[model samples]
Target: MRLIKLDATASTNTFLKELAKSGYLDDFTVVWAKNQTRGRGQMDGNWCTEPGKNLTFSVLKKMEGFQLNKHFELNMAVSLAVFRTLDLLKIPRITVKWPNDIMSGSHKICGILIENSIVGISLKSVIIGIGLNVNQSYFPGNPKASSLYNKTGILYDLEELLHSLMQNLEITLSMLQSGQEKVIHREYHSILFRKGVASTFKSGDGSTFNGIILGVGNEGKLRIRLEDDSLAEYDIKEITLLY
Candidate 1:
């Protein structure tokens, strides 16, 4: 694994993708930026991090034997890797929000963005971008954002945390490569946020409803048991969980 550090970039994910096109990047290659001018998140959301105070990096993972249909499994693996890295630090109330948001209690501490390259049904590669709040103590626009320093009152070593994340990521990805799908599935749902708790959700049509998260399906859709006792699956854009 090769690691590159950048003083600043528009987006680490974007930079890593271009590096991969140069035929110089290998599986597990990492690109970390001290500052990202145009950080990104899932969907069209923007990930804002104080320069030099957060972990913003992208990893290039070369897919060899994985099937394209099991891409959600990759999400589960990466999410679990981050969870394990934080768990070693003994972060309390750690939970994985649906589709890979890392939260400490009610506040988000990390976000993951995965971009995959595919040809037909064959898997090619994936660029996994991670944004982790480490030393930042304030969020100007997002009230739900929090950092490790805010939660623990202790500043963490950014390099140390990145090393731990990469180690845990390797173990998790190995599980997926070895076809341990059932184990990955069970562990992911076990730490899922609000798996059985009742919550309110908003649909794309601006309608709100009460539901309980049953877990996620293999295709990465959220499964909810609605008030009418009917179960339904929703895509990422179709619904939003209102905390």
Candidate 2:
């Protein structure tokens, strides 16, 4: 549980990955940045957060018995950690927007990006980056982005929030080692945003359609029941849920 606090960094995920490559980092080593110059979300999306107003950090998890194909389980575990931590904070309407984004009602409050190091079909290690909105009252361009402060009208201590997140993350990540992947699957899907509800989606080909989010597939793909009543699976890049 080595923790490094940085005043500013390009990306904690990048920093931790480099440290891990040096072969000196222990499992659960964390790098936290006060100001992330180039923080990234899933699919290289820019995560814009005011300096010192949010939680931005990455964790290094050394894998022991995990395979390469079980990556989505990591997503589930991490998402549930943030989701449950927010729950402990009494944030209302907590739900995980698939692949891995934490949502409070209709607004996104957190984003997770996971990078894995693989060697011959085995996961050597995993780098998890998390950006959580804490005390930011406003978002300049992202209308659907909100923070714990905005949602609760109360300012929170960033260190306390980070502590809670780390504790929950440690417990959830252990589920992977304990063979509780099925428990993660069941709980993750239960509160999934828009599960079983008719929703609009845009395909990669620029076609708009309607569908219902059935659940997530074994490989972490979104399972949707299309308008034709056909069940289709899609990874993050192939589809976008239009609310």
Candidate 3:
């Protein structure tokens, strides 16, 4: 893995994208920033943290002829990779909120945003952007947001964490390529937050409803069993997990 350390950037994913467009890019190349000015989470949500107190990086995953149907699998793979990295740290009550938010109990600790380049049903490459709270002590405006130090009270070496996470990421992505989809699927569902439990959700129309999270659909939609016993699938933007 080629590592590019940056003092700061608007966003690591955007920086890496420009690099790829300018020249040939290697797979698993990483761009890490000490400060990310405009970090974005899932659905354009803003992510901000203390400078040099978090992990703001993007990785390039290049592949040829990757099937379009396998897109959701890639998402599953990335989510599990983050979970594995967090697991080794012994964080308490770790769970993955659907689509891709890594939470420690009720407080969020990390977020993943993946960008893919595709052509005619074949994936070309992807930029997996991760923002993890490592040593930050406080979230000024967002009480629900937290850091590893807050959760564990142990300040971590950012370089060491990045190395371990990259290794796990590489191994997990390779496993997906090696036909280990079923295994990955099981692991991901096992750690899903609120899975198999009654939860409240808000739709795009701002109306709230109750359902049980069965699992994610093959298309990456959240599968919910409604009160009427009818199953419904919803895209990420179509539904929001309120609980």
Candidate 4:
């Protein structure tokens, strides 16, 4: 395990990807930036964070037994890891949105973006980018954003929180490496946000409709039961859950 702390950077994920390309990455290596200038979100969306007020980091995990087909299992494991860390902190109403967004009630406190390095039928490595709002109180235009201090009314030590998250991640990853696929699947859907509840979603063609989230597929696509009682599968870019 190696940790690199940066005062500022364009994006931690980008930084770590460069390291992997240089063949200098170690398993469980982490790159964290205090001020991420151009942080990323799902689908090329820009992640906006107040400098020095949040946790923006990327973890490089060498996938020893990771299969290309069971990619969503990795997502389920990582999402559960973050959920466990937040739940351990006594953060109320922790729920994982489909894929890997961690929500506190209705507001989002954390986001994860995974970049994988694939070689043939196996995944060589995976870069998990995490953006967690910690102490910042204001998100100028984003009303669905909140922080630990914003919700808990107490300031938190960023280093302490990051350490806790890493510990939880290790435990969850161990479960994954041990082939506990069923367990991970069950646990991930247990706290999934809006699961089994009717919700609005927007399609890639700019059409909106109501559907019930029916958990995720093995390949990470969101499965939804529409009004007609038919099942539909959508990849990350194909649909957006309208909160």
Candidate 5:
């Protein structure tokens, strides 16, 4: 549970990865920054953050004996942790967009990126990076982004929010270690976007469809029921969120 705070950095994830490679990062070590100059997101998109007004951090853990195919469960656990943290702050209208985006009424509040290394059938270590909009009042050009301050009209202390986030993260990781996939799975489903509602999805092969999101499968794939009542499974890249 060691928390290292940085005044300013390029990216917390990259910093932690370098530390992990140099054997400086240990299990439960958390690295955070008040501002990120070169923040990144899924698909190489830029993660926007207001200096000293957002949550940007990385958690490093050494996991062993975990199935590689179950990595999506880790995503679920982390998303649930973020959701629960915001919930505790009494932030209403927050929901988890499938895979790992935290949204509040169609505006994104947080994003997660997970990277891992494996050594001969055992997970060496995992770096879970999170970028959350905390006290920022507005985004420059991203209309789909929102912050806790914008929603609640009250600013949050960065350190206090980080403490709450780490506590939830520890609990979620413990549940994963204890084979409690059902706990995160249920929570994730409960907050899933477009649940039981018709939505448009674009697949990797350039095909689009109108389908309903039933729930994620045990293997962590998106389970969609098409208009014809046919069930289909999609990996992260296989489908794009259209809402």
Candidate 6:
């Protein structure tokens, strides 16, 4: 595992993408930044953070012979790893929003973004980027964001937290490589947000419906039971949480 720390950068994910494209040797190569000038988020949103008060890092690994369709399980593995790391830190009020957001009491604590490359019939590599709010005293402008410090009332050493997160992530990836998809599936569902609760979801075409989350399907799609007793599957981009 090689840890590369940056005093300041545009974004750890961007840095890792460049390294991966350049064919960097990947076992456990991590790119981290204490401050990101242009941090990114899913759907072009900004990942706001206080410099030196959060954890922004990316993990790159070469995948061999893994099926491309199983990518969502990989996401679940990473998500559960983060959840476990926070749990070990004695933070018990965390849950994973389907597909990838870590939340505590309706406030988001972490966000994950994964990018992959495929070459012919083989999987080249995957870059898993994580942004975790660790010790920020206050979020700039959002009632929906919260940090570990705000929730726990204790500041955490960024390095120590990163180390623990990487360790857990490595373990989770190993489990996936060993064909333990059920393990990841079960654990993720156990900590899923709003399970069994009726909530509204917006489809890609902007259609909305109320349904109960029944857990995720084996293929990593969200399974929802609609009012008509019909089952619907939605990918991350195809659905938005109305709550």
Task: Write the residue-wise lDDT of candidate 6 on 154-211 in tens digits.
Answer: 9999999999999999999999999898888889999999999999999889888899
lDDT tens digits, residue span 24-60, model 4: 6678999999999899898889998999989999999
What stretches of model 6 exceed 4 Å from their correct place? none
lDDT of 3 by residue, 1-243 (tens): 999999999999999999999999889999999999998777877788899999999999986788988888888898899899999999998999998889999998999998988888988999999999999997998988998999999999999999999999998899989999999888999999999999999999999999999999878899999999999999888999989
Pick the winner on lDDT between candidates 1 and 6: 1
Task: Write out the backbone clash pairs for model 6.
Answer: none
**Which 10-residue window of candidate 4 scores lowest in summed lDDT?**
64-73
List the candidates' TM-scores in order: 0.98, 0.97, 0.98, 0.96, 0.96, 0.95
Residue-level lDDT for 243 in candidate 2: 77
**Residues 1-243, candidate 2, lDDT per residue (tens digit)?**
778999999999999988887867788898999999998877777877999888899999988658878988999999999998999889999999887889999999999999988888888888999999999997988999999998899899888888889999999988878999999999999979989999999899999999999999999899999899999999988999887
Candidate 1: count the clashes. 0
lDDT of 5 by residue, 1-243 (tens): 899999988988899998887866568899999889998899888786878888999999878887788888999999999999999999978889989999988899999999888877667789999999988887878888899999999989988999999999999989998988887888899999879999999988888889999999987789999999999998887889786
For candidate 3, what is the TM-score? 0.98
TM-score attained by model 6: 0.95
Error of 1 at 192 (Å): 0.6
Candidate 2: segments with Cα more than 4 A from true spot: none
Identify the runs in model 4 with alpha carbons over 4 angstroms from their true place: none
Candidate 6 at 62: error in angstroms? 1.3
lDDT score of model 3?
0.92
